[model samples]
Target: MHNYFILLISLFLLSVSCNSDYTPKPRGYFRIDLPEREYKQTPEKLPYAFEYPVYSVLVNYRQTQPELYWINLVFPKFNATLHLSYKTIDNNLEEYLNDSRNFVYKHTVKADAISETPYLNAEKKVYGILYDIKGDAASNTQFFLTDSTHNFIRGALYFEVYPNKDSLAPVLDFINKDLVHLIETFEWN
Candidate 1:
């Protein structure tokens, strides 16, 4: 009766295994390590000067029609870049403001929400709006600063990798603090 016993045991094991529930585990991402915060001032020659993270590398933006004041602040560790474009506001402040707003809204199809945080420093004469775009939009952060008389600057933060809010939340938060610090220290030259 050895064969009979073997069959019974196999059947019992199969039934026990079938009765156990199986659940799929959620996907996971690798942990990200951020660097310590330290900043240095932008070069005095730039039309605008601000303190940026020491971890970032400042490079001139390459374009077919590159403007003198256009530059990029790149974070090599995170594969992200902050593009800064400057324009002289020759009574065209309204136009520049509209363009910045339109650029932020273009990502609404992918953004869950867009929040605007007003930044004003009367003593420094630096005023701007920081746009925090939520979700899988191309750019997670955008901002525009103006002296309201002569200078206007726009900046957008973009990552080289695909945008996944859940995966990139930690890095984004860390960089956001750096951006805020830069804004606070911004000055027109």
Candidate 2:
């Protein structure tokens, strides 16, 4: 009887220990769906002419700083936003870039990852910065597109959801394609 009791106690302890040793389930990721790429052209309303995604709309008009203007497109599904900048310049391209960087700096937030890279041509002096902001209440990517002078344009894409680069990757990819299209289509007067 003593031996049987000891055996039962050992079995109970083993079962309890086994139950405590649980393996947590893996984390599930979000599955986001994106839209097809369709573009609509903007009329010759300014110095330059271009086209943007049909799904996106232009916003933010300031008469005071006409030279420094922007168009914002909000993506409610992906919980993201894209800000396209249009700056009428009267200086060197490098100067424009410096000023553009300063402008983007204002929209930047703490707990974010910022990446800057010059794109396309150097002598033509086209440059851009890709902002991947994480943990920000207002997360977005600001694309700097400029003609070096007379024009310092930027396109910013952001999301209201928690900024997870992985989750946002698909949306970013699509928006980037649109952005690239916009840049490719950009022509100076």
Candidate 3:
């Protein structure tokens, strides 16, 4: 009787386990504490100037073959950087525009969609295109500013970690406002 009872209990446990489905939970990222928005102007000698977040550090261009007037805004807390490059038009406005488009499109393979917003300030002679890259691309924002004559500036924001739009949405949205503010305050030196 004892042996029969043990066998019956074991069979009942196996049957119950087989009837239930096991689904794994999704992965999660650590919580981020973002700082309040504050800004400061770039140095006077730079070809162009804009207000950047006070929380970020303005670092000299450190990438390969860094050029004059190229700089990076590093967000240490977020592990991201906004790369800014300057180019003299010299009748190459079309080429610069094409390059900026190409850079934005490169992420299309991973991007769900890409949107472009034109920015024009006749008084300041600052005209540009702002790209909002969606999906899991490496960059969430890219832009190019040109006077259509002499100055052309291109910028892109990149994170150190793998692209995960869902996880980075908050940070991206926060920085987007800053980007827009920068464009609004941009001035040629």
Candidate 4:
């Protein structure tokens, strides 16, 4: 009876030790499906024009900004918007340029790094600066194109969702390519 009692206690101890606590798996995000790159140019009569992705939609921005030519590129799947503001340079090029730079700098507190790439197409008379902001900034890309005389247009890509870099990185890259295509084909009317 002593041996039986010892065996029973040992078995109970072994069974209790073998039972482990339940641990749930870490959280995960849904897989994003990216579409092929296709684009079409804006319609005639606009002061400026650029090719945008077919997957996106162009909507007139009804913001409080005084500019009447403001527009947005809406990416429904990603819940992102590319806001474009147009201004006819009336000797205010310098001020507008500074404002554009300042807007990018506002993200400095959250950005890990900010890099600017200057673009100039002498033949097309298009010149601009492209800013790539890394980290958890509200906007990841911003740019401005100007003829340095008559037309100045600024654009920034922002997401409706929270600024999570890892979750948004792939979408950012995809839109970055579209933005590049737009700039390459941009023309001032």
Off-target runs (Cα >4 Å) in candidate 1 are 1-10, 13-18, 62-65
- lDDT, model 4, position 111: 100
Model 4 segments more than 4 A misplaced: 1-26, 62-65
TM-score of 3: 0.87
Best by lDDT: 1
Which portions of model 3 show Cα errors greater than 4 Å? 1-18, 62-66
In model 2, which range of ten residues has the least summed lDDT?
131-140
> Each prediction's Cα lDDT score?
0.95, 0.65, 0.92, 0.93
Predicted candidate 1 versus true structure: per-residue lDDT over 120-167, tens digit per residue: 999989999999999999999999999999999999999999999999
81: Cα error in model 1, Å: 0.4
Task: Sort the candidates on TM-score, descending order.
Answer: 1, 3, 4, 2
lDDT of 3 by residue, 1-189 (tens): 999999999999999888867789988977889899999998898889899999999987646635788888998988999999988988889999999999999998999999999999999999999999999999999999989999999999999999999899999999899999999999898
Instruction: Give the winner by TM-score.
Output: 1
Each model's TM-score, in the order given?
0.91, 0.69, 0.87, 0.87
Estimate candidate 1's alpha-carbon lDDT, on a 0 to 1 scale: 0.95
Q: For candidate 4, list the clashing residue pairs, or say none.
A: none
